[model samples]
Target: KMFACEHEGVTPDILVLGKGMTGGYLPLSATITTEEIYGAFLGEYEEFKTFYHGHSYAGNPIACAAARGSLEAFRNNDTLEALKEKVAYFEEELKEFEGLPHVGNVRSKGLMAGIELVVDKESKDPYAPETAVGWKVAEHAMEDEVLLRPLGNVVVLMPPLGIPMDDLKKLVRVTYESIRRATEGKPHNGNP
Candidate 1:
């Protein structure tokens, strides 16, 4: 889906988009709101209801061009439409981690996913922060030339939208191996 809210059938009052706005080519952000909300700020000169907001790069032309280019590429290449197969493959590949002894949860949307690691699957107990279990798993992946970032005990996987199937498979395989090396056969008593 283009956005998660659209898929959930919820309309947001305000939507803030960044990061992928320019496909990481430049820093750009956009705030979108319904026209009804925007019109509320309009009034006579004395109404004193003007919304004043400013930022250093608020309207940078270079960033705007990059954002436009990203949108054009999305439309021309049918990016979202093309993701159907990839998304299915991603979901299927992610199933491999579900039965792992240390995997607490696997959540995904589009090309982004998070694998939550736990001390005990039955109890869903989290490892102590100092244990850095997530970081250890990431390190193991890095050894195989696959970069990963951790959110506490959750290892995040956010690959590029245009990644090939072969690379996606490798990403999952390396991540699975990393988790195994980091958690399997290890005591989860909470000490690093």
Candidate 2:
């Protein structure tokens, strides 16, 4: 299904998009289709067959305005180009912690990243769930004035798209410190 839907010359009958569509400032999504699809329901008044799906905020003017402004800013600032460079730098800097004593893996795409912690690097075994290693690391990061959230045993970083290089460095440093503090004096047979 995935391959067929994504392959060349194969167009989906309906396209549903969500998440980051409005840069996550508001809750909104869209179901887009071609004019042909819409024409199928265009008929006489008595024969009208309109779909019935609604949200209280559907067609919200404020959200539409925000989306337009965000798109404009993206184009005016060449945000995609800038992100291409920034993401490359981010990935390189993030990888530096790969062999840290408690760090298991670093995975990143664009400006989003996840740092996994492990109790045994060779075995790639995660710390006990009850240990709350990820949660503790996030708390320590907050203490350092950097916010992070944990997904299971992985610490996820979703920094803003246009974060400055200096700030990015600070983020990496803070993450390292957070991990160290969270696991300080604890025995782990990981990266060492």
Candidate 3:
């Protein structure tokens, strides 16, 4: 919906979609466009206006079957509605970690979130890149059996959408503990 709204004017000549399109099971992508674009290539056989592009396995029947089943599951089970409720609960729980000593901000939408960490809250000074604070937090989380990835000093969370509320709570808890462990006793103001 957001993409449609943002690209309203530019009637897409080609639409390419991949990653999470089929729930990330089998790596597949698609290109879709109006018949008008396809008709543009309707010319003499000698004419070289035909655009040709192909993947090694462009139309694997099994992948198509999986995509079809996934779509049906989405409609029949209202997976999106359930996801909305879960994301709402998750975001509300994430808010509890705000205002922590090293946590600069918590921003989230749907099932994704980024927790930015800073050395100082007043000036919003990020930890030195050499310190690799985000990496440390991610490593600590892994030690606690919570896998996480960091983008720069921002800890990103993209947990599975269907995680139960209890597991979600544990995820948040482990994330908080990991951050605390990483930054604890470290000088926030670059002083001893």
Candidate 4:
């Protein structure tokens, strides 16, 4: 919201938000749209044009309460402001992985990052699905006590918003080590 509304000076007509809304507790989401968009749905009920879209568990009070709590937590901690140093450190630390042979790309925004591993670094050919490249790196990371979740062939690093500096560095180092182990010419299914 801040990035779009302030940084880019853009206002979206409609915004659909979920996942973090309920603090990952109950499955609930909300759609917020401009008055102009809402006006489009302002037809007579007799015309049966009332916008209708919802889930069974929509507007659950418990979930809403959790979401409120999450918001409060953010406000109390000023989480974004506090995470600046940590985010920068995480980014700088990620630079080391670029030297690795199979590291195709290392992209990041704040705390969310992805390290793309490639079979052919020059051609940027991604590993086969059977190779499970991303998962392999995550598996190796887990061995070093760094929990990782990969998005397909990109090993995604989404640490907690306010993770400690030490932990964030560990995450970077563990991720680099993991990618190295996965792509250092080790045979998977005897496909050397």
Index of the highest-lDDT prediction: 1
Score candidate 4 by lDDT.
Answer: 0.79
Q: Which regions of candidate 2 deviate over 4 angstroms? A: 1-15, 33-52, 185-192
The model with the greater TM-score, 3 or 4, is 4
lDDT of 4 by residue, 1-192 (tens): 223354467788987888766556678788989999998889888987788998898888988899898778877888878878887788888888788889899988778788888888799998889999888887877777778988888988887775777788778877777788888944333111
What does candidate 2's lDDT look like per residue over 91-191, in tens digits?
88887878677788888767778999998778888999999999998877777678888997899988877687778878888887778778775332332
Weakest lDDT window of 10 consecutive positions for candidate 4: 183-192
Q: Between prediction 1 and prediction 4, which has the larger TM-score?
A: 1
Q: Provide the lDDT at 188 for model 2.
A: 29
- Which window of ten consecutive residues has the lowest lDDT sum in model 3? 183-192
- Error (Å) of candidate 4 at residue 177 is 1.0
lDDT of each: 0.87, 0.76, 0.77, 0.79
Error of 2 at 113 (Å): 1.2
Between 1 and 2, whose lDDT is larger? 1
Q: Rank all candidate structures by their TM-score, best first, as comma-separated numbers.
A: 1, 4, 2, 3
lDDT accuracy of residue 170 in candidate 4: 77
Candidate 3 residue pairs that clash: none
- What is candidate 1's local distance difference test score? 0.87
- Backbone clash numbers for all candidates listed: 0, 0, 0, 0
